[model samples]
Target: MSRLELAAARLAKALDDLETVVSPLAKARESAAVAETKIAALDAEREALVARVATLEDEARALSGLTEEVEDRLDGAIAEIRTALSR
Candidate 1:
């Protein structure tokens, strides 16, 4: 082959190699963007769950105080009956 023709062939081969290399890189970038979107959605869901947990905890605390008051009243009634019977 003439030197000019040989040089042209080499250039074509190099262009094919570059296309193959760049295509996968573009696909990888698209995949990364999709992954980031999913991560943001998951983070928002986690924050909502945390808020629900806090509300449940507050309700449980209020119920605990009510139980304590009921227990105290029962104990006092029992003590008063025992004292009257002993007198």
Candidate 2:
């Protein structure tokens, strides 16, 4: 073949090889975009769960304090009964 024709054939072969190499990268880019979207959704969900947990913890703390108050009152009544019996 002539030099010019040989150069054109080589150029075409290089282009085909480049396309083969780039096809997988294109798919990978698409997959990365989807992964990023999923990650954002997960982060939002995690934040909401954290807030809910905080609210539950606050409620539990308040209930615990109420329980302590009731116990203290019961202890006082028991002491009064014991003193009366001692008389």
Please name the candidate that would achieve the greatest TM-score relative to the true structure. Answer: 2
- What lDDT does each candidate get? 0.97, 1.00
* lDDT of model 1, residue 69: 93
Report how far off residue 40 is in candidate 2 (Å).
0.1
| Worst ten in a row by lDDT for model 1 | 66-75
Model 1 per-residue lDDT tens digits across residues 1-87: 999999999999999999999999999999999999999999999999999999999999999999999999999999999999999
- In candidate 1, the residue pairs with backbone N, CA or C atoms under 3 Å apart (3 or more residues apart, or in different chains) clash, namely none
| lDDT value for model 1 | 0.97
Candidate 2 — which residues are off by over 4 angstroms? Answer: 77-87
Q: Which candidate number would show the highest lDDT if scored against the true structure? A: 2
TM per candidate comes to 0.74, 0.77
Q: How do the residues 3-80 of candidate 2 rate in per-residue lDDT, one tens digit apiece?
A: 999999999999999999999999999999999999999999999999999999999999999999999999999999
